[model samples]
Target: MSRTPEAPSAPPVDGARTTDSTGPDLAAPARRSRLVAVDAARGLALIGMIAVHILPVYDPETFEPTLQWTLFGGRAAALFALLAGLSLAFSSGGRTPHRGRALTATRAGLVVRALLIASAGLAINQVMPSPAPALGILVYYGAFFLLAVPLLGLRRRTLAGGVVVFAVLGPVLVHVLGPVLPEAAAVNPTVGSVLADPGAALAQVLLTGTYPAVPYLSYLCAGLVLGRTDLHDVAVRVRITLVGTVLALGAWFAYWVLVLQAGGYAQLTQHTPWLSEDQINEILVWGPSRDLPTSTWWWLLTSGPHSNTPVTLIMDLGTGLAVLGLFLLVARPNWLWTTLGAMGGRTLTLYSAHLLALAMTVHYDRPALWFAVHVAVAAAFAVLWQRWCGQGPLERGITAAVRGTRRLVLGAPSRTAASPRS
Candidate 1:
């Protein structure tokens, strides 16, 4: 089954002042508005992920990819990852990176957050083991957070460079190392599996798993660059939208030229004799089988969803950026966007609940009905909770824990506030 990206942190509060003890307050009025837009975009990502999880990807009769499959697929996960990076950037110091003791505290807090999220994922994995209905992304998200720690201090240009390097090299590394590494013990690895063979578990999360952190760094770095920009400017938002559209189209064009136009598909058939032409096509439409066949280098040129090829990475990144830019452009202080922002703010809690609900319920029988039910319930809960309570229940707890960690590290009253819509 295809996997969707899980939510990360809660959206940061608006107009919260950051002191020296905390970080600098990056959320001015315009910045606050930008964050609300970010929340709306994240809300869309959350809804898209739910649709992917619940709805059919392929039409049963035709075996053709469904509309939901085409729209969500890997793109929703990419958006989640990009937003995660943006969240980190905002929390640390939007536009200006945190330094000294503040930086240390922020990193420490992030580590704590990573561990908590991973632990939750591990516990969930025990219930939803291999061949589970939905694969939990929380564990891999932990690794993503940990990997991002070192790069948090970097500026936009350097991070942008990192995006290119990771996009190109991550897949190459996977191709080289995938053949030698032991196959992952389970699709959704548990704590027991990790304890049994740490190396295999590490290998899976880093390289061989469905959502490997190495290749995903491209999305994170791209988001970091976006976070550093002056997002309040209309010119900046327009440029982002234009550049993102061009990048997405360009990547798709390159893939078409390289794979279909060139002899890349033929090369694939020649190399992987086990898979028939139809089977290969299925893999293209439905994503990889077990893992992408490393039988030929030509596989790198194909840009299927979750293929993690350079082209796929670039394309997904562009799409994610474009979505964010458009949301930012259209953001207004209105009821609709505010409600969406509220839902976005509670994603961590909501996504976790969603996974649990999937585990307990039989959603496949009537996926459309179930999808609607889940969205409506989640929306209602988010709206009510935002009205009654400021932060989400789980988000509030995580924030408290993160704040405590920061205080422990700084050995003082830590004033570093959470980033808006982070």
Candidate 2:
């Protein structure tokens, strides 16, 4: 979600570094360096998302999901959400965090940015001509930002604790509350839906929609916690890698024990006699048949991708963290890593462009080729743009708008603070 560091930096609190805003500081050095590991992780996520959009999930010959789908799928989006939270932390004052007037300014900036993202998402949904709609994440991103506003001020420990609470409680809450909520149309929501059926749209975004904010907030909070940590430290990265892997693998093992081998599937079969093994495999690999199955509580047991169930949430969050840690571990001074990190830096531009490309009819004919083309174009453009322009077009535009808005909202006095608006 964050293009570049704009938030004011401060000393670390208990070894955790403080964060900065997304907009650039005019007085700051022109050749600003970014956190390579984080950017590389983000780049990896963006590519995975592109694969999800462009490549076939299932192989034509085998009717089984390709490695791309199995590897990326929900994990990519989870990484994106996690990175968004990290960006939020940076924007809010990093480890130290902002207080009083600075806090107010951060909140205002986030709100405005959320509005812009949501608006763009709606507009894209309306205009993009995909034969089958793409599940636009921009709207969900906007909601996540809005939801994160209130949680921005907390310390590292508190935020980490929140991750635990959200991981367990958020899914339970969704399971209990989601069914009663009004279901919106299955199609991607447009701006027209906001005007014509505001309630349904709101409900969908908050509860039932793809990438619903309620459950996905767990990833965001986890990333926020990670952001507060001393990401630059090798020990920290190692610890994160170990812990995240354990959590991820542990979740999978739990699911295997409780669902696959524990008669949960049998319970479902007893209830829905028409269910097939292929369908079950699809749920296992792709996600749940729907968001979840209401017929049996056993659905809550599996850690399938995008199930939005407790087990799956934990698994995805762990996998995301593990992937992030691995990226950080491998992120070093190299041409490949540098290029990938550059690509990650311009995610706003590349992601939006990728979506637009998907809407085009020509690209649909040969998705693998199109996927490769988009990646090359995005990577090349990112490297060149980072060298020449210093920021992607959309990144620059949004940061400028946010800076202007922050300045207006906070007035002249706030601008003179230790951290001036970029």
In model 2, the runs with Cα more than 4 Å from the true position are 1-34, 130-133, 414-422
Most lDDT-accurate candidate:
1
Residue range 1-422, candidate 2, lDDT tens digits = 00111111111122232336875443222112226767778888888887777778878898887888788878887888888888887777766778988888888988988888787788777876634336778877788889988988887788787787777777776678778877776456778777888898898887777677877788878877886776666788889888889988998999888878888778867765666877766777777644665666777776667777778778877888898888777777478877877888788778777777767766667888988998899999989998998877877777777788888877886446868768
The pairs that clash in candidate 1 are 12-421, 22-415, 22-416
Per-candidate TM-scores read 0.93, 0.88
**What TM value does model 1 have?**
0.93
Model 1 RMSD, rounded to 1 decimal: 4.8
Flag clash pairs in model 2: 6-21, 7-20, 7-21, 18-94, 18-95, 19-93, 19-94, 20-90
Worst 10 residues of 2 by lDDT: 1-10
- Go through the candidates in order and give the C-alpha RMSD of each one to the true structure: 4.8, 5.9
Task: List model 1 lDDT by residue over 179-241, tens digit each.
Answer: 999887888868988998899999998888888999999989988888778787899999989
